[model samples]
Target: LIWAAIHRIESGLNDFESQDIIVGTLGLLFGLIIANLIGLAFARLPIIGAYGPIVFSIVFGYAGMSIAIRKKSEIIALAGNLRLGKSGKDHGSKHKDMEFSGKLLDTSAIIDGRIAEICSTGFLEGPLLVPVFVLEELQLIADSSDLLKRNKGRRGLDILKQMQEDNYIEVRIINDDFDDVQGVDSKLVRLGRKINAKVVTNDYNLNKVAALQGVAVLNINDLANALKPARIPGEHMNVLIVKAGKEENQGVAYLDDGTMIVVEDGQKYIGSTVPVTVTSVLQTSAGRMIFVKIANE
Candidate 1:
C-alpha cells in the first residue's frame, strides 16, 4: 500500500510543469499563513481547539494548491506585473507564458512566408491562431492596387491555405477583434493577451510594441538568426570577395546562408578565393555581420 501510494505521487509530480510546481509551492505557503492566523483564534475551543492548528494546516494547504493550480495563468501574470514594477525594465509588459502556449500569427509573420516553412518543419508546435482581423488585413493587402502589396497579400493567403491542408498541423482562424483597439498591431497585442497566446511576428516595430504592452512575441527573424552558424573571432575561411563594401578598403563576401562578411583591405582580391581570418562578429535585430582580414595579414 505504501509503495503504491508513493508510485502514484511520483506519477502525479511527473505530469506537472516547472511553473506549476513553483506556483503551487507559493500557494501552499500563503495558505499555511492564513490557516495559522485562523487557528490561533480558534485554539480555545477545548477538544477542537487542541487540534485546530493541525486541521487548519491541512485544509488550507489543499485549498491553496487547488486554487493556485486552477488560476495558474492569472497568478503568473500578476507575478510578472509585480516584478516589472520593481525592475522597470520594459514598458512592463506581462511575462511570456509557457513555451507550448498557442501562437497568434500577425500579418507580418504570415506574409513573410518563412512561418509556413517553420511550421512544416515541426519546430513550432501548438495551434496557430490567425485572428479574423489579421485575415481581413491580409485580404486588404492582397486586393491592393499596388502590385507589390497585392503579390505579398496573395502569397500570405496561399501560405495559410497550404498550412491548413497539412493533416498534422492545427490552424485556427479566430474571430476576436477588439473593436476598441485602434490598429491591427494593437488588436494583435490585445488578442494575444485575451487568449494567452504569443504574437508571432517578424516586424521589429511590432515586436517592440507588443513587448511593451506585456504581450508575448515570437519573432521569426530572431529564430532565423539564432539558427545561423556561429562565427567567432579567429575562425578562418576562404571566399571570393564579391564586391566592394560601403566603407573604404572593405570588400564583401557572403556565407552560403546569406550572412555578410566584410573583409578589411580585401578589394585587391575581389574575384580571387583568398583565405581570411575572422576578426569579430556583430549580431543585431537586422542580421549578422562578420569582420575579417586576409589570412596572411
Candidate 2:
C-alpha cells in the first residue's frame, strides 16, 4: 500500500512537469512562511492564543498556497521583471522597434478583402508593406486556368488598388525578394524578420509557419472573429437555409460576413428564410459557427 501511494504521488507530479512542480513547491513554502508569521502575532493572546494561532496558520497557509498556484504566470512574470531590473540594462529600444513596426501584407490577407476595411477604420497604423513576390503570386493566380482562382486574384488586386488610392493609410510596394526561399510564405517570414514587421495573413498554414519561424503574425480571420457581435443561446435571427449540412435534419447558412450557421431540423426549410434561435456559438481559428434551431419548433 505504501509503494502504491508513492507511485500515485509520482504519477501526479509527472502530470505537472518541471516548471509547474517548482512553482507549486515554492508557493507552498511561501504560504507556510506567511502562516508562521501570522501565527506568531496571535501567540501572545491569553484566551485565544492556544487555538487562534493554529487556526489562523492553517487558513492563511492554504489561502496563500491557493493564490500562488492560481497566479503562477503572474508570479513568473514578476520574477522576470526583477531579474531584468537587477541586470541594470535598458531594453526599451528592442521593444520600441516592435511597437512601431510596419505590417507586411500577405497574399492571403489581400484576397480576404477585409484588410482594406480594417485599415480604413484607422486602427492599423504604419506603412503597409506589400512584397514584390506576393504581387507575383497574385498575378499568377489571376492568370490561372481555374475560374475561382482568377476571380480571387483579381479581387485582391482591386483591394490593393483601393488601399493605394486611400489617403488614410500608406501602402508601399517592397522590392525585396529572397532567391533561397522557394515558398512565398517562407519569403514573407524572412522579410518580416528582416524588417521587424508583423505579417498580416488569413491563411492558417501561413500563420502557423510564421509563428514557428519567430515571426509575428496578425491574422485577419482572427480579427474578424473578434469583431463579430457576441451571440448567446436563445437569441433569434433570420437566416436563409442555403444548403443541407452533414448531419440529418441540419441545414447550413451564412451571415453577411461569412460566419457559418448550422440549423437543426432546417433541411426541410431550404430556399426559405426562417427564424432561428441560437443554441450555441463555437469560435474556431478559421471563423465562428452558430448552432441554431427553428424558432417556432
Candidate 3:
C-alpha cells in the first residue's frame, strides 16, 4: 500500500507540466493566504470557529488549483504584458501554432488500420504520434488470453509496423505518458492536452471524454460516416438477396458497401443476384436503407 501510494505520487508529478505546477503552486499559496484571512473572521463564529480556517483553506486551495490550471495561459499572458505581446500570444497559442502540432494515435485507430492508407494519400499531414503507453497497451492486448483480442492486437502491431516503414507518413513514437492516468484512454486524452495535438481514435466514449475535456479528437468512424455517399431515390444497382426481410414477402440484400437493400415482393429471389431499381431511400438511426423493386418491374 505504501509503495502504491508512492507510485501514484510519482505518476502525478510526472504527468503535470512544469509550468502548470508552478502556476498552480502560486495559485494555491495565494488561495491559502486568502482563506486564512477569511478564517480569521469566521473564527469569531461560535460553533465552527476552530475548523473554519481548515475548511476555507481546503475549499479555496482547490478552487485556486482549478482556476490556475484552466487559465494558465491567461496568467502567463498577463505576466508577459509586463513585457510583451500578451493578448496576441494567448490567442495564437490556442489557434495558430497548435493547429499543426500533430495527431495522436490511439490504440483503436492503429487496430482499425485505415490510418496508414489515409496517411499514404498525403491528406493527413502532421506528426502521427504513436505513444509508448499506447504501444504497451497494444502489446498487452496481443498477449491477452482471449484469442480474438490477441489477433486484433497483433494486427494493430502489424499496421503500426507498416506505417513506420512507409516513407511518406512520419510515424513518430512518443515516449511521454501519464502514469497517474489509470486507463489508456484517459492517458491518451491527457497526453493530447499536454501536447495540444488532436487525438485520432474511433472509440465513441473516448471521443466524448476528449471533447468534454476540451481536447480535439479526429474520430475515424465519424470520418467514414461523413465520407459515405448519399443515396437518393431512382438509383439502380445490383445486389444479392441473401435473406428474407422482416416485413412480409420482402427480400433483403446488401450492396457491396453494406447498405441495406429491401426488395419488394422478392422473397423468392433469395440466393441470387438481381438488378434492382431504387424506389426510395430511407435514413434511419440504425443505417441507410434502399427500397427497390426488380429491374423493369
Candidate 4:
C-alpha cells in the first residue's frame, strides 16, 4: 500500500509526460488517502476511537462482499442463458429445415391487411417471422394518441393473434435488434439478409432497397397486381365513380379488388355506379392503372 502511494505520487510529479496515467493513479491514491484520513480523524474522537476502524471496516467489508457476489452471480446467469439459447437452436434444427423458407414480415405488410387473406388461403408457406423490434413498434402505434395510427396498430396485433391461432401458420418472433438502424424498413432488409429469408412488405421503397441488396422480396403489391383481372380495351364493366381523376373529364373508381379505374367523361357520374368501356391499361412498377370511358347511358 505504501509502495503504491509512492509510485502514484511519482507519476503525478511527472504529469505532463504521462497525464492520463498520472490522473488515474492519483485518483485511486486520493480516494485511499481520504478514507485513511477519515479513519484517523474518527480514531482521534473520545471513547469511539478504539473501535472506529474495526466498525467502519466491517460495515464496508460486508457491502463490498455482497456487491461482488451479486456481480459474479449475474455473470454466471448470463452465460447459462446464452448456452441454453444456443442448445435450443441446435436441437430445433432437427425438426425444422435448417435452411429456413421463412418469410420476414415488414411493417407495411402487417398494416396492408391483405396478408391475412393470403395467409388464410395457405399461399404464404413456411414460418412467418416478426422481429421483436417490429412488435414493439406496433405496440407504440397501438398506444398512440392518433386514432388512425392506434387503429392500425390494433389491427396489426389482431392479425398477429389470428395467425397464431391458425395451425397452418407458424409465427416466429426474432429478438434480434440493430441499434444502428433507425427505420424498421432498413432493419427488415438487414434481417432478411442475415436470415436468408424473403421479405413480405407493401412498402415500395423497401422493396426497391431489398432488391438492390439482392435480398428476395415478396411484395404484396406485386402479388396483387399479378392476381388482378386483366382488362382489355373495349371491355365493358360497371364501376362506381367514387371520385374525380387527375385529368379533366375523368373520374376514378375502384373495383372490389382495389384496382383503380379512370373513367373518361365520368366526372359527372361521380357518386354513381355506371357502365364503362376500358380505353387503355397502364401497368407500372407501382401497380396497374386503367383508363375507361363511360358507355352512353
lDDT (CA) per prediction: 0.84, 0.84, 0.82, 0.77
lDDT of 1: 0.84
For every candidate, C-alpha RMSD to the true structure in Å: 13.2, 23.8, 11.2, 16.9
lDDT of 3 at 65: 82
Per-candidate TM-scores read 0.65, 0.62, 0.59, 0.63
lDDT of 3 by residue, 34-98 (tens): 99999998898987798889999999998988788766644654564443344456656443333
TM match of model 1 to true structure: 0.65
What is the descending TM-score order? Answer: 1, 4, 2, 3
| Per-residue lDDT of candidate 2, residues 68-150 (tens digit) | 66555445545655655555457543432233346889998999898999899999986788988999999999999999999
Q: List the residue pairs that clash in candidate 4.
A: none
Check candidate 1 and list the clashing pairs. Answer: 93-214, 94-214
lDDT of 1 by residue, 1-297 (tens): 999999999899998767678888988999999999999999898988889899999999989987887666556556655664666556444433233357889899999999888888888876787888899999999999999999999999999999899744678676566766788998888877765679889989999988898888899888999999888899999988999999998999999989999999998889888999999999876778999999998
Worst 10 residues of 4 by lDDT: 68-77
Question: Which ranges in model 2 have alpha carbons more than 4 Å from their true place?
Answer: 1-100, 145-148
Off by over 4 Å in 4: 1-100, 271-273
Best by lDDT: 1
lDDT of 4 at 158: 91
Minimal lDDT window, size 10, model 3: 92-101
